[model samples]
Target: MSKEQQIHGLRPIIEAIENGEEISKIYFLKEGNGVLFNELKHKAKQANIATSYVPEEKLYKLTKENHQGAVAKLSPVKFADLEIILETTDMTANPIFLLLDGITDVGNYGAIIRTAECTGVTAIVVSEKGSAPINATTVKTSAGAVFNIPICKVNHLKDAIYLMQAYDIALVGANEKASESVFESELNKPIGIIMGSEDRGINPSTLKILDQQIKLPLKGTIGSLNVSVACGAILFEAIRQRMF
Candidate 1:
């Protein structure tokens, strides 16, 4: 973590949040207690910023400067507003949106972004929490594709899903147990495809709300594929459908 990528001290962090900065996450000392710290916590919660309480040692490792028991990691790229993209994008072109559910690995997230951009996805959406931070490593893994694509962070994945539905874009999720295969699903129209974390396929609540669920057929003994690989397969299948 570079000093340029982090904002140290409680006051600076609070000011950054007030200024609508794209903060990836914040670390706070477990033992720290003060009026300003409480105010910071309130503002962070209101902004839906991911935060963690850690030991002072963790803060020291993050930065040698006087952190005042707080440090915030800044995102490498600015996040796009989901509602704005929804309103401005041409739905007639069958724009495809990729929604990530609980994807915490920066490498996988980056690879997914690279694949999405290559496949002509309109944007990528993630939850404000549990999703991977768009850090330096993510930028490298993405091959600089992160900046090329619009990534929207929402307070909750469900909220984004509902908003997409309001836009009349079909919502589908990638699930191994889904009855329909990705190749067979209707991806020729404007759609939002949900990809879950590597460990958990998809949240049960999230899976229930999707307009449809899709799976990639597997002949080998492997039960499932990597999230990024599955995303590529599904996205390309969508492209194939739209092209023909």
Candidate 2:
């Protein structure tokens, strides 16, 4: 983590939130508590910032200064508004949007962004909470491609999914148990591809709302591929379908 991308001390974090800064996540000492701490928690919750209670050692590891039981990781890039992107983008071009659900691994998130940019995805959307921080590691791993694409952080994945559907975009999900293969699915359309976390496939409730579900065929014993690899495969298939 870069020192420039961090804000230590409880008061500073509260002020940052109040100032409408793009905070990726905040961490606090699990055993620490005070009126100020409570206030900070309230502000973070109100702003929908992700928070975690960790050991005092964790706070020290984040900064050498007196962190005062709090530390915040700042997002390197400002996120785009999903509704604005939906309204302004040329939807008639058969745009492809990628929605990430519970992807916490920075490397996987970065790789997915890189793949999305390369495969001509219109934009990428992620939940404000439970998603990976767009820190230095993520930017580096994306090979600087993060700057080329618009990334939207939404309060809830379901709301964004619903908004996309309202705009006439079809929703599809990548699931191991899905009966249809990506190659056989129709991808040359305005579609949103939902990719789940590394551990869980798509959320059951989310899967229930998608227009279709597709999977990549697996011949070996390995049941599934990494989320980033699976994303590339499906997105490339979409590209191939549109081109051919």
Candidate 3:
């Protein structure tokens, strides 16, 4: 972890949280506890920041200086609010949104953002709890594209979907079992594309809410494509349709 990435000590961590810093997670000595530690932990929980207990050796490895038995990892970019993005969206144009469901890989997340930016996507929505942390690695992997696009973090993806639906944006998902091909799907409409994690495709419950599900036809022996690659393919299709 980089020095710029971590905030050490209880008082400093508390102040950072109070200052509205984007803290990804907090780590504290497993055995350490006191009024200050409890306060820090309480503050982190209230802020919805993940917290973990680590050994002294781990803290030492993270920083040689005094950490006061607590350290917090900061997100490189502040997360955007979904409601705010929707409120400011230009309803006149056919908006294109990308919704990531449980995608935890930072590299894939970064690459998806890069593609979304290139394709002129309106915004990328992700669940605040399950989404990957936008750290230095994600920023670097995106080739700095992470900074160019608006990424809305929502409490639940379903809520974002419902909001977009209310705005007349169709929900489209990329699924292997879908009978329809992505190329055949109507991409010119105001739509939101849903991409799932590597382990599981879209959650079964989420699939129920999709207005349409699309599949990318494959001729080779390979069964599936990486989530990032799949995202690029679908986004470019939308771009092509919108351009013509």
**lDDT by residue (tens digit), candidate 1, 1-244:** 8999999999999999999999999999999989999999999999999999999999999999999989999998999999999999999999999999999999999999999999999999999889999999999989999999999998899999999999999999999999998877889999999999999878999999999999999999989898999999999999999889
Order the numbered candidates by TM-score, best leading: 1, 2, 3
Report the Cα lDDT for residue 89, model 2: 81
Write model 3 residue lDDT over 1-244, tens digit each, in one string: 7998899999999999999998988889999999999999999988888778999999999899899999899988777887788788887788899999998999998899999998999889988687788888889889998888888777789999999999888999999999999999898988999999988989999999989999999999999999999999999999889889
Off by over 4 Å in 1: none
- Candidate 3 or 2, higher lDDT: 2
Model 1 pairs in collision: none
lDDT of 2 by residue, 1-244 (tens): 8689999998898889988899989998898789999999899898888999999889888999999999999998988999999999897799999999999999999999999999989899999888998889899899998999999999999999999999999999999999999999998999999999999978999999999999999999999999999999999999999899
lDDT of predicted model 3: 0.90
RMSD of model 1 against the true structure: 0.9
Error of 2 at 243 (Å): 0.9
Off by over 4 Å in 2: none
Q: Best candidate, lDDT-wise?
A: 1
RMSD of each candidate relative to the true structure: 0.9, 1.0, 1.5
The candidate 2 region of ten consecutive residues with least summed lDDT is 83-92
